[model samples]
Target: MRSLAYVAISVQLFVGLQCQSLPAKVKKCHYGDGKCLVESANALLRNFPKGIPEVNLKPFNVLPVRDWLLVNDSQVGGAWYFFELLNQINYGFENTTITEIRGFDKDPTATRIEIHGKIPRLVYKGDYLAKGRMLWFVDINSHGTSESDFLNFRFDLTLKVRIEYRNNKRYLKIYELVPNIRLDRWIMWLDNFFPDNEDLTIAINNLFNRNWVEFWNELEPGILSLFETVFLSLFEDLFEKVPYDDLFLADEDSK
Candidate 1:
């Protein structure tokens, strides 16, 4: 019965999206105006959670992930770890604030765009599996549920785009997206690290929460890659539906 209800809801959402019109609240910014671009970005972020149904985008407040694996062959504190998160749900992107926009005033023909933004907080809850050897002696293996909070999360994004002519209209295609992400602090909780030893599990959880910076440093690369993939897909979805002229105002149109 639950599965049937879910399917029904999904179908209703799809039908509603098909009947919607382009978002009227979207404010097109002048091509070379940094301030306007920043404002436009913030506006889009505010609207992202509810989704732009005209573009077939779903709500982005909660992002679901099947699994992510991070393997570190190099030693950190004389230890190497393999970590994986499964069935994860990440939240809080819709509250992001655009701090600055750059590279927008470059040559009119330039294909690069740079953006900087920050989120007050982001939370992730999921199942985690990890194993590692420490100091060539302690063998660690664990699997259970985990929740992690990222405070003051910030990111710098660089996008490379190409112009596409389709149906006599010009569209932007994102060819590459690079993201640099950081956080002021991380708080983590993991259950059942050592299934047979409750005290050991508590100690391990404490150790991770106390020294999250080290763990974040080790996890940064994988996390950045994950963001790139997710954001790229989102950008492509929007760009494919909205023509370039609809997103940015031309010189004469700006006036």
Candidate 2:
């Protein structure tokens, strides 16, 4: 019966989406415009989780992981080119609720949303391929599987987003996302491998956590780029299901 209800709801949503006309393109909202965009954003976010229960990516979704410093050759006691670690992973969040939204009061250009929820689970199953040289011999086939998981994480993130519009659609680009992620109460597993030679998983984890700030600094660029893609995709997909006018306000409504 519960499953049937879910199917019914999904169908209703699909029908509702199909019936709505595309929102008309309006004048762009500028910084500190004191326009209706802010109010519209708030209204749209408050109605979240009602129509947007989950957001995810499939295993086929290419999550490119490049320029990641797995373990330098010197530290790993060899020459390791943790070259390209493509994550063929499927992950997302469920039961999401937006707690608050700020900065849009005057500056719609820089807006922030406070979100509280659990990313039900994340399955990162991918290949750990690399190349290394040890003892004058290069092991080009440094290959294995990399699997990780976080059963249920209770955390909050402050998503700083930059909004843009093109062709009648609102584009939200994440400028900075500060997460107060609490995985301490949750069991997170990270099982990375590199052939039968050695299991440097523990050491690798420690190195990254050793200097939290530096670690994030070294990887921020790559991380931010990945986030931009994910967020843009999510917003684009969202507007597809929900009408644009329903999410943002028309210029005249602002005043």
Candidate 3:
């Protein structure tokens, strides 16, 4: 695919705020893949095709949203939902709730990471929810010995998060984001025309799923360019209803 160009869309014009100041290396996450988008009823619906949803400048300056992610629904006081994070996301719950984690059921440390955030995982301890009209924070305090580089670092960070109901999924820049469920089906349909070569099936599936990263890497530059244009476009369409936002993470465990 073409390298993401030096594209710079104004936050105020497109998103309407500079929630946080981000480092140059950070790239914003759009509303697709890797789980974690929000379910805001018609909030996303109003933003696409029919019209642009009004930006909630209430939390006006959230910047550097890292990855797509949402606190597990079970812990969000109700239904199942997710938030998107760009990279890895870490959470730090409030101490007041440290002894009273009533919102979440399982212990954060003990719960199994089903898909490493590709799937829903509870957000219990190290983070705060963006509900009830108050600003919440997620803290990242890590130590790299001074002998290595600058001073040890620790600080509070803010991120954009959303609650997305599976039934209520939506996306920005897209109207519908149902996965290319037909891609595999199409391959199978085409396969019927080919002989029943089990080896070919295995090879193609492997090429498309497991090794596709490398496979994509080897595509002619021109082909890759076209592929990304079509691929990201499709993704945006399929998942258009999910609430979209960018998040920033100082480190993996801090997301």
Best by TM-score: 1
Better of 1 and 3 by TM-score: 1
**How well is each residue in 149-189 modelled by candidate 1, as lDDT tens digits?**
98999989998877787655666777788998888899998
Give the candidate number with the greatest lDDT: 1
Instruction: Locate the minimum summed-lDDT window of 10 residues in model 1.
Output: 103-112
Alpha-carbon TM-score of each model against the true structure: 0.80, 0.45, 0.18
- Comparing 2 with 3 on lDDT, the higher-scoring candidate is 2
In candidate 2, where is summed lDDT lowest over 10 consecutive residues?
53-62
Model 2, 103-194: lDDT tens digits are: 43333354455544445554455655656664555554555566545455455556665655544544455566655543422222234433
Worst 10 residues of 3 by lDDT: 93-102
Please list all clashing residue pairs in model 1, or write none if there are none.
none
Q: Per-model C-alpha lDDT, please?
A: 0.78, 0.46, 0.25
* lDDT, candidate 3, 1-255, per-residue tens: 233332344433343331223223334222231232222212222233222222222110111223223322333332333322222222211110111101111121222111110111212112222221112332212111110000111111111222333323222242221211101111111121113455653464445555444533443343333223322432333234223333322233223
Deviating ranges (above 4 Å) for candidate 2: 1-83, 95-107, 133-140, 160-180, 185-232, 236-245, 248-255
Ranking by lDDT: 1, 2, 3
